[model samples]
Target chain A: MTKTLAIDCMGGDYGPSVIIPAAISALQQHSDLKIYLVGPQQELQQHLKQSPDFGNRLHIQDACEVIGMSEKPSTALRRKPNSSMRKSLELVRDGHADACVSSGNTGALMALATVLLGTLPGIERPAITAELPNRKGTVTNMLDLGANIDASAEQLTSFAIMGHVFSQLADDVEHPRVALLNIGEEAVKGRDSIKLASDILSNQSQIDYVGYIEANQIYDGNVDVIVCDGFTGNNVLKACEGITRFLYDQLKTEFTSNWWSKAVSAMVWPILRRFQRRINPDQYNGASLLGLREIVIKSHGSADSKATLFAINKAITEIERQVPQAIQDQVAQLLLNTDNEDEE
Target chain B: MTKTLAIDCMGGDYGPSVIIPAAISALQQHSDLKIYLVGPQQELQQHLKQSPDFGNRLHIQDACEVIGMSEKPSTALRRKPNSSMRKSLELVRDGHADACVSSGNTGALMALATVLLGTLPGIERPAITAELPNRKGTVTNMLDLGANIDASAEQLTSFAIMGHVFSQLADDVEHPRVALLNIGEEAVKGRDSIKLASDILSNQSQIDYVGYIEANQIYDGNVDVIVCDGFTGNNVLKACEGITRFLYDQLKTEFTSNWWSKAVSAMVWPILRRFQRRINPDQYNGASLLGLREIVIKSHGSADSKATLFAINKAITEIERQVPQAIQDQVAQLLLNTDNEDEE
Candidate 1:
């Protein structure tokens, strides 16, 4: 199926140079895929000089302004209307693109996307959901990763429903088991909001609500979907990233410490590389801003060309799967069923 | 100075068997330490059979009831008055012991400790603070790890103050740099309560407030103390644990995949083991329940004798340092200073 994506060219660390190539590479990978490279025209054109032509499948959309990584969301929304991030979202909103992929300022991207593309029905706010590589070699989808810091019980329930649909579609996990992220596995554990959300999910007929799971059990892969408020989810994700890097650095230090260790490290380097590739954060670069009216994939700001390609491909996949549409249907059905249960 | 510790022998996974041996080891390590072994008389005696007696140093306090791992905190408080967990705390409450060490149910332990010993002056609730091994080979003390689910701005400021005092006393770091855990380092990022806490912390002349820090910077060791609400802190801590195990397991699987890999792994096993010990959760086992009237160390529920000894030693360190008195003094002074500032 033919799908179009608006690439935020003036986003991330490398900006146009990294994103333009990734978009071009993505276009090559998917023959039916089209991308609107949104950025400052002259700079983007200069960076795109090395890229091979792909006819009308690739085109440039001028966005004079660029959002700084540390730019406040409200400031970005008010001041930077012509930002690459905003332009990318505008493409999706105006039906020029099926989805938007940005490795830009997350706050700016979220704010601009929410303002431009709006949200799906019954979802008060969109959630940022991402796949974390787990023990089972499959991905565990966790949601509300810094979108809404203090999600109410209803919002948490929405996240669970959206996460369930996402896992089913994105990972092709049938009957994806959903669990609430808490300090303890017991029902009595966690804050009142979490407990209320648990109660709401327990009575949920749509999702495979498997009760509360601790953060330690996240990578165990016993459950497919892990739901938490944005604050907890964001902290957990970043902490995992932090520890992964710390351990890897420690391993590298150990391998290079002495002559004997260095020699053995050379022999085991291939095996280690293979293992590293499996757990590489680049593979999981794209985080979907779920429950949005149109799809928006937020790539890591430091993502290289390869990682940006992954994010672009994520947009393609979402477009193909119609993730937003699936979420809308699922949420509507779930809410209707819930209303019926409440009435009964 | 002889310091007395009340050990909840019926706590944790291994219970009396693990706790008794660990207590024995702790006694051997600390010559000036006295222990009150709180548990069932017959079981405690059986576990102590192989241990060489220290005359009048180790006394068994008979508490027949044991708090179940899954027992509700309120239920445990109400029904299990004779529980070993409660008895250990009671020893502290009655001034029989300077500190209490439990590897039992955390919720019950916190509830019982809070109810029996009460909070320190100018403190509403106690926080669970533990040291995480950071990249700099030193530890970062993070607080409110699942003790208080929803901390108010005032409560968070109190946590920062408590954590500051703890780092000074326990970690022996002068002018410890403190930071509020947030999704972003920006002043506008995170929830309102976090922002309010930041505002409160910035004006405080008592401690070195280093502004906001993301969770990914947690292991950088740039910040001495990281303070957050219990929910976020707990999730981050657990997620770090989860990822560490996940990476190690992946490494193990890779190293044991083939004969060549296995042979290489054999040569590198010693190095790997050394690296593992550095990041082992067992080494950082004891989490201090700070802001309480007395010292209480909650060890991991699954901690073996080695880890349990770490917890016991932690209690001894707290007793020697007089952590509670220090926190009480610090909190009182900080409150008085804040009141003076308000008047000004």
Candidate 2:
């Protein structure tokens, strides 16, 4: 019943300062969890001395080189062969850890994950998947959040299959409804790639493919899973982050305008704060690199202790569900069906 | 100075019901404005009977057909040559109206606008440009919002130039700062097209191009104009709209959760309502098809009268600034300079 997670302590903006505390907090919450802090031993040791029995539950794995937040994936892979990012992923690949969590450069993490764990049987590329808060008080899974741009029709269908399996585990939903992200809901709308993907997904009887959903309906939460290429996915994700921050910033500016407003703010601050917490991007920090041979979660680079802790919990849940096996079964079936049709 | 606006009254979800009322309101606000309502005369007469001396400011041009909200651009162009959308654009081309506004299918509108108005010299394609609310009170202009997808590096550079001229007119900010929208703000990041466009933009001395901007900083209001290809632009626009609406919907749900919560809402409803109005997507309804030889604005297909009226006002503003001529002059200079360099 024990789950093990490899943490890239040298990743993200805060590096070990955020990662070490987050790992300790996660250990306290999960009784049957063990963590391997992968980074320069001295940097992690400085923070490890802060907590009692920290060395007992936590293990250290030394990685000499660290990838910068903005470093190119190819260069990082070539130059930082012994990076914490690579070491953490290697642990997952070798079955030393049940899963790996990193807040490193997204491109670098994706590149390292692909090389180390490979991909699913039929999946050409592993999509980056994450849950987003929606209007229905339930979460919706969105994929390819900046891993690969211009994903082909076949790749998009693979993303839907991967997301369908992910929603079952992450959201605990049966027959998860899947939809393609587009500019309009009409079947006749969008580019040729989306149209081709729609045709392929619709033919799969097992897939609860509910046709197209526009970007404007993303948070409506009508569907459990939303699939798109990395270009649109990245733009949509960042746009949401930008608007959420803007709305709260506007409220802060409005509340401090006058004494009357300030009094009103005091009375409603608690409810407003709660609403803010629900919509915060940091609360939904872990983004799974779905379709990989092994489970690998990408945490936000700017994640603090609380966000990083949430990411750890996400990884643990993914491990508990045995996500890789579920995806493999689904992908294998899909590929077999495709092969049969090709021969005919 | 008086200005004339031609409106496709049969466009959008509400059709004549929303467009007529909105036209009356806009005409009332702008005392020196003339309106040409391009649609069936029967619908116009029914609505005009309500207003006193409606015939004084409003003119009716009968069009027997319409393009559906989801109609393909090519199909609509071929089938509905007598559509109100086409008639409205024709008014602008014939110099009968200073500007034209439509709430028809975006694809149809863009296609019609391009054919009717033609692209400016050196401009490859006319981009669908719109203003968005940002952290600062001022608006940021975003272009290529699904007018054309997969824009070349040269087209993107042209968008920046077109957007720069638009900002100077619509926003009234001289030397407006422009930035390319990418996954990351770093210079070395993004696809080849975006990188090539960024390089070209940075070299243009007159552009005030400020390198790259990621989606997270979109609402930060750091740049005056945000430029991207149609695909990313459309997705980003819809994403922001989706989040803005989602937050408001969540707030409404939260406030009505319990009697105690209802009591809290009663006291804070005024402030909350104000915030909702300020961030409403309807308030920023008009999307101008930039790079065209004449001014043509595309209103949201689902726009109500309030939003439609805002779109009318948007056309008036463009008319006052002669936006098309301004862009034409700027683009002409750049092309002539390029031609001179080739000769050298």
Candidate 3:
């Protein structure tokens, strides 16, 4: 069966410029993939016209309204009925598309996804997972990246299970080592919620639960999945981005300064490009909103064509993997066990 | 009076290897400064014997006990009498030394400082301030970097004041702009604690308070002082360090693998060195534990000789500026104003 990805073309900073071309590019590269572009039909079509002979594979879904980056998520969702983000999600909910991708307001997409597709059974909250590039060629999936700010122990446990399944399916890590992000490696060193969640995860037999991982150990690639509350995850992600930008700016200043340094920079340009490809945020463009019945990829709002194409490809992968079905089955078994324990 | 810096010679990973040489280097640069090295006299003397003319400027106090990094901080203080960390703080508390510097367990240091030196009159909790290198040449002081995990609104307000004072003293900024770290730039975006703190800071006439600062805006060099709870601050610090290390490793791989890249790396070595000096953590090694009666600089445990020397220098600067007195005076006025308002 051909996989169709619903792209929210009106979402993100350079919306159509990035999203349209990205969709066209991905569609051309993956012959089995189709894209349903959800945005202002006229504008999206105009952008798509620039690409050669891609009309057959690309479809447009008219979405008259757009969600502004600064708009309050809940208010925007309720008021804007025809928003591109909302339309894109509806396509997934109604089974018109296999997955949905948006680079707009994160909170709004989360709310809309939960409201439309609903969370999987036994999952209290749906978590957003972003792939962090480690020293190894593989990536570590970090969850709850600004999805639920105040998470209970139960919610955290659910996140771990979902993250484990997603990693196994999406990243193809067998028996993925799931860890709780704590202040220290010891199980006793964190807040009450962390301590309780650690206990729950330890008791669960389904996951290869690593005791705890500190923030400093994040780059060590000791764990396949690192789980935390949305607040901490968001702060960590932003901090990493901030430091990367800081270093890049510092390096740029160094290379452009003197004659000898410029000579050196010219020689290392290819190697630097290779390094950029590995760790660049644009490469790992989409973060999956896991535990939803349908797959949803949240792209960066400031993404260029390269990043948007990466997001579209992510949606295609999710559909092909049948990640949602795998999640649903795992959650169903967990719910059954919980019900049995309660009866006992 | 000659400034005396009490060094916790037994605190860090390499102990005397790094700290002793760093102290000697500091003395070499600043002849006016005297060093009170607190550790086991035999070990310290052995290390001191390696440096010529060290006896004239160095004094050794016998502290047989040492605080391990993994020791329970609360239990370590009550159990280990004459511990190096405790004795070092005692020197400042009794006015034997002008300032104290340690690379020991951060929790133990904060606890000992609070117990021995005590907080300023109106300050409820002490704050830890870390200097973050901005894109520009100047640095911004970020606080409560793991001093207090849970902070009240009043404590946050005081943190802003202390951070502002710290930046001014350390960075020589005339009117430092203080900003509260929040999830969003809007006034209503954060929790009640942040909102209340923002309200209190905006009304305070003594400090130059900028509005809320998002994590993305931290490196923009717009604010001289960034204030938040210890949990958030610690996480941010660790995350930034992780990313920096990751990027550095990636760059090293790019520059060393091939002959072409190696030639470029050699040519760019001068420029890279300049850039490295700008963002070097060694340049900003010490973090002041503010609100104490005496100055204390927390050096990194993994610090090299250069970083250790920088911490000692920071301690001397704090003593010279009389930062504690400035903070005490400001806090006392704030308390008096609160009392007057209550009377009305």
Candidate 4:
């Protein structure tokens, strides 16, 4: 089956320089994939490499305006209708592309996507979900990462359902163990919304609810899906990013503190490089906008060409698996039915 | 000045075995510091070593009960009035000890400490504050780590003031830079409460408010104090713990992957050891229960003897610096004065 993705060419720090190479490589890697480069037509065409696959599979949809990285979502939605970010999502919404990938301003993308594509039947809001590399060499999918800051009990339940389906499709886990991200594992811990969500999830026969798991247990790889409010999830994810950078800097300082240590560092550089590759963020760069009617993946704003390729691959995988449809089915079966049962 | 600490000998994973040795070492290190081992008399005495300082400075406070790690705070407060955790706080309240150090159940310890010692003037709830090592080789003091889960704007403002005072005294940063932990650095990014707290903090003449900061910039060493609601702070801290463990395990696996990598890892083991020691949690073990009328330090529940010593030292420092008194003065000068100004 052929998969088509709309690529935002004017997004991210490096813009088309990094994204064009990544799109070219993605096309070369997957013969059945087609990409629509949505940005300024002249600029995007100038960076494109002359390949036999260029006109056949890769096409450019000109977008005149570009959204600033720090622009407000409402302002961007109102003023920048011709932005590469907006055009990319429009491609997916108009059924011209199966999915969209961008490294644009997160808030703007979320607002535009919600307004343009809407959400699944039972999901009132869309969540930004991502995969974190766990200790078991697998990935743990966490959701509501800065999308809905103060989520209610019902919104949290929706997150858990979306995360559950995402893990099954993305990570290929047979029966993904779902858990609430709380401060403690005890039943009485966390805020009232989390406890209420736990109660609602416990009654669901579809989700393999494993109760509450704290942030310290998130990377242990025992649980597959971790659900939390966007406030907590965003803070936790960024804290992990901070700590990773801290350790990397600390290691570099230690290995170059003295002449003898520097020499030893040179000799052991290969092993260190291998270790770096094992936990590199580029290998897992895409954050899927879950609950949206059309698939949209957000690449890290500072991602390089390699990381962008990973993001492109992620969108292809979601398109192949029909993630949005799958989430709709599961949510309709679990949540809407549960609501009806509660009323009865 | 002579500083005395009441150590809960029955707390933490190793209990008396770890606490007794840490107490002995602390006594040997600081000649003027006195300690009271608060626990079962017979069990505490059995773990003691033969030392001349035992009778002169280290005394025993016989508390017959012990609180379980997983016990509810309300249950422990009502049923275990004579618990070692409670006895330690009581010692501080009754002026028998200048401060107290406990590696007990955090929720139980916080409840007992707040009830026995009370909150300082203008402070309604105590927050758990801890130092995280940053890239600049200094520490960033973050607060409200699981004390009040759903903190209000007033509560968050209180946290900023307390954190500012704590950083000045503990980290020795004159006019410490303070920031509210948010998802984005933009003014319109976070929730309404955080926005209100930001407004309150900005108006305070005492606080060196530097506006908002994202969690990814936390370890950059650019800010001295980061304030957030307890739920976000707790999850962020624990997520850092999770990522640290994850990277360490990944590095270990990479180094032992093959004979060549193993030999190289062995060759560079000393540099790696130094790097590990630089970022070791033992160097920074204690989390201060700030905003209390009296000083109390809670050690990590799984801390070994070395880590416990750091917790004891933290309590001694706070006692010497009069942290609670400083916080009281600041809160009075900032919060109370601001309220009066608002009314006028």
DockQ (Cα-based) for each candidate: 0.83, 0.73, 0.57, 0.77
* Stronger candidate by TM-score (2 vs 4): 2
Off by over 4 Å in 3: A49-56, A334-344, B53-56, B203-206, B334-344
Q: Which has the better lDDT: candidate 1, or candidate 2?
A: 1
Q: Write the per-residue lDDT of candidate 2 for residues A175-196, one digit (tens) a residue.
A: 9999999878777778788999
Ranking by DockQ: 1, 4, 2, 3
Q: TM-score of chain A for candidate 2? A: 0.97
Error of 1 at A268 (Å): 1.8
lDDT (Cα, tens digit) per residue for candidate 1, span B116-165: 99999899989999998888878889998989888898999999999998
Best by lDDT: 1
- RMSD after CA superposition, every candidate: 1.4, 1.6, 2.6, 2.0
What is the per-residue lDDT of model 1 for residues A1-344, given as tens digits with 9 covering 90 to 100?
77999888877888877888788889888899888999888988898788888999988999999888888998899987788888888889999999999888888888888889988888898999999998998999999898888899999988998999899999999999999888888877778888999888777577889999999999999999999998899889998888888889988999999999898889978987998898899999999999999999999888999999998888888988999999899889988887787677
The sequence of per-residue lDDT tens digits that candidate 4 reaches over residues A301-337 is: 8999999999999999998899999888888888876
What DockQ does model 1 achieve?
0.83
Q: Give the fraction of reference interface contacts each candidate recovers.
A: 0.88, 0.66, 0.56, 0.83
Q: What is the TM-score, restricted to chain A, for candidate 3?
A: 0.95
